[model samples]
Target: MRVKKLLLTLLLAFAALGSVALAEEHKATPAHETAASEEAAYESKSLWKMMTSFYDTTGLKAIIEPQDGVKNGLGQDMSKFSQSWGRVIMFAIIFFLFYLAIARGFEPLLLLPIAFGGLLANIPIANMTGEHGMLGIIYNMGISNEFFPLLIFMGVGAMTDFGPLLSRPKTALLGGAAQFGIFGSLVGAAMLSQYSGFVDFSLKQCSAISIIGGADGPTSIFIASALAPELLGAIAVAAYSYMALVPVIQPPIMKALTTVEERRIVMKTARKVHKLEKLVFPLLVIMMTALVLPDAAPLIGAFALGNFAKESGVVDRLSNEMQNSLINIVTIFLGLGVGSKLAAEQFLVAETMGIMIIGLLAFAAGTAAGVLMAKLMNKFSDEPINPLIGAAGVSAVPMAARVASKVGSEARPGNILLMHAMGPNVAGVIGSAVAAGVLLSIFK
Candidate 1:
């Protein structure tokens, strides 16, 4: 019986070995045949060469077909141009707009780079619009991860100086007032999301869209990327566009809100802020705002660090490096990543146009809020505050302040609203970040 059993086992082992060998030989037939199949496919190609062909490219065929039936015909899609020309046109338009903005000096600082990135993303291979392209990979790696926004904040921080706000802490109030747009715009976006069947904005999308009123690009990008990544392209474009148009958007609002006397409103010249005051103001702000609203602490922290580095007289090397080289690099990546999110399918919607509109309302509301709040503050203070500076409280930084100066000078030539407006301008930065924190916490 034992001998019989052993012979039976030996026979079974031999059978198994033959089956294995046969399987190996069969695999080799197809594995080796793939090169011929790929060569044939390549030779049959048109003017375009085989570039990063995802399927049957490495002399290998998939062992099995996709089980999901390759949703949305992504399998048959094949990264070709004919089917994706719609996307190409959108990208081309963006490129042309960017060119117009750059060469013609319309928001050239940001629009040019964004336009270039938009073009690169729509090259009709691997569909950077949806997934699995170089731009897509970069977008997921950085923007989706919130790395670009945070790093961009660091750069923005380095460029800012809180000296004006430090000189007159009261300007911080105007900054806080300017954030009225956040709440006001939230109502508008919420209304649109409720009423518009075209494209609905989620709670997160509403919050992300609301920050555009903050008039701070990195903050808008960061919040939107985290909360409403789909809206990144439109939100970013609108944010920067409005920022460039600050001089245009704000002055009209200023004129409407205040009289010539208010436009020409002069305040007591600011006293010299002590060196120690400048040194420690950033630290105190970080501590206070971090405790009060930790959601915005990252943005606030980075900005404060930059300000401290600038004022501290120490770390000159780090300061210079952060301001120029570091910021430039981050800006490039941030711009490109933002552009990658602007796929035709995602951006060419009524909601995109709506976002742009709501963004304008937000800017207008924030400006109005700042101006009215400053005018109100003027009622109580013995030392009058320039109502014009109130408009600078919208976090457009030096741009908003510069606009205040320009407008102020138009009323009374040689009037330097720049220094005065700086106070509220820096304050607006903090206020917008706080608004960002509020939105983040509620939606988080």
Candidate 2:
């Protein structure tokens, strides 16, 4: 009986071993089969699938593919161009920008290229703005590297005359005062983020948006690129649009702030600025700014170099090239490059509307601050300054200055505040650069 029991136990042990081996085989077979299938699928991928999947969802194929299955038909390919609300709205925005450029002549040079680039960007399947595409190349070369803004600044510096600003050093204060808008807009942005919970703008994004208060497009672009690259298109569009509308925007604010008597108040002629002053000014500014705020060195440095070339009177050829040829070329590329960010996916966001609204407020605040500061100065000083010139301190360059002069002349015919307004106008540029530097230092 004991022998019989031993034989039965041996049989049971062998049967258990066979069951375990069968289970192991079952597990290994599925894994091997899955590996082989995966390899086959990867190898069998169609050219269209391979091409569309190259960059993942960023490619046209990935976006247009149906939820159920891969359809490489023409209809599916063209669907993104028409089916998406973002793309459709972007088309409207692009057309509106074109109308503004061609019909109203609002920033025609920049707007035209921007509109054209936007048009190119919206076309489906072309992938004009993909990694290796033309718009992408332009963006990576100029906007991504932050070279275009500096180039624009160089050209602006070469063309700029600091004589007016140098002659009236005190007017630089207005420029400094106008920067209140930037900081004020910061408060507004933070408040919006805190209270609304609708758009969560970080400190960096707020900084980029607030620079719009400077009313300087390149500065806005530079700050946006450094701090909030995603917001570049909306911030830039708002900055440039408000700048072009300076004629329309500033006049109402100017009339509302100053009395006719204040507007008509004419100041004495500015002292003649010597060439030595002009030559030394750019160098002095560069040295002082570099020593104080090295973070802003890129913008301040480029601007000073351009000014140096212009003022030194030694590099007229280089200066002329920077002011004209170099600037013009960069402007075309810069506009188009900036427009690349205006792609539907990027632009049609809640943050864009916030940027536009806040930008307008910042501009208004800057104008008010400059005017108020000038009024305060008038109370303390013997020199009579037309408070109207304070509005020119937003650094829209000649546009702000021209509006100041126009408004002043309108208040009192023959009262030319162009040259006087120019003092604060140019000063505003320096002030804006300084503000940008300050933000860079803090954030960077």
Candidate 3:
């Protein structure tokens, strides 16, 4: 009886607690309702304004009134000009690059990514080229730090066979001669700066711009980053564009420079280079670079390591990775990083026009110089040397060499100048790097 009575008391106490809790919840309901009502009222009042605000944040609005403080190459405020027209021009350029890469089969591997990155960079609100963005991150990681170009040099070395150059040391002179374009363009840029009203390139800027003549994209980027980073976009684009247009650009110059008989001149096959010589060559080159031009040691060292790996025959896996996978990956990042500089404010300048014009002339000068050098060498040589092979002296690699072979084959039915051209072609790679080192030593 006592237990039952205690239980009933406990139940009555629990019922009282429940009633109090329900009453408190009922009292809080109006506060929650009031808050929700206020939110609804605010939304109703500002719906149109919110829609308008969203519209203002859109790409169209951003392009029409690009965020203020846009500047040109001369450090003048260009916000007025940069409004919609600058972005439109950049878009046109991006699309043109796409056309070249896809439809025209230009250096698609690099050009495609670069074009896409340009598209990203020009998207105003996205700020893809800003410090915190994707392209900026990539640019800082590889390009600004000068990592990508060196890795590319390593990959190039791994892929390149110095056998042809080793077999005929004379071809190194043709490669060296091709670098005349770089120096000649330097003088041209300096002259343009002095004479042209629109262009104002400093000596450092001239140094950076002239590297476009090397026809070596990575070397150009390296030199530009070190010497005149402001001109990097124009220089890189010029370098790669000319490199891609090798077939079109070089053939005209080659044919104009050489006679049909000179093109058809059959050179004897070079003696096969021994494995020991091949192994020793990169070491010697690296040692010479270290002793003479330590500035070039980084590039030459990377190249030598790759070549050593390839020649060792023991590190075939490592060599293959450097040549194929490593290079392919770096090329994608390098392209995007380079394209990050293609923003409207950065690329669309009077200086870009100057860079383009000077770059073309530089390339022409290099080609002409190489062809002329070969002709000069041929005059003194016992064995016949095709003047057409000298055109491959621009560091465009196998493409230039292949063009030489194609032109040679056209002149004479089945003559293969591919191997012969490769000697100077590979040598041009070394020559360009050495030239970059010299520029860096002087400018940096």
Q: What digit string (tens of lDDT, one per residue) describes model 1 on residues 275-310?
A: 898888889989998679988888888888887887
TM-score, per-candidate, Cα-based = 0.81, 0.83, 0.88
Checking candidate 3 for backbone clashes, the offending pairs are none
Cα lDDT for residue 285, candidate 1: 86
1 or 2: which has the higher lDDT?
A: 2
lDDT of 2 by residue, 333-425 (tens): 999898887877677778998999899989999999999988988888789988988999999999999999999999999999999999999
Error of 3 at 99 (Å): 0.5
Candidate 2 has a TM-score of 0.83
lDDT winner among the candidates? Answer: 3
Model 1 CA lDDT for position 263: 78
Of models 1 and 3, which has the larger TM-score? 3
* lDDT of each residue in 1-444, candidate 3, tens digit only: 453455456546745654664574465456556645677667643664464467567665565555677543234454655556777778777877877787778888888888888888777667777678899889999999889999999998999899999999999999989999899999999999999879999999998999998999889998898888778888888888989988988899999988898988999989989999999999999889988999998888899999999998999999999999999999999999989888887888999999999999889989999999999999999999999889889889989899999999999989999999999999999999999899989965
Full-model lDDT for every candidate? 0.77, 0.83, 0.86
Q: Which ten residues in a row have the lowest lDDT in candidate 1?
A: 58-67
Clashing pairs in 2: none
Residue 362 of model 3 has an lDDT of: 89
Candidate closer to the true structure by TM-score (higher is better), 2 or 3: 3
Off by over 4 Å in 1: 1-85, 129-132
State in Å the error of residue 223, model 1.
0.3
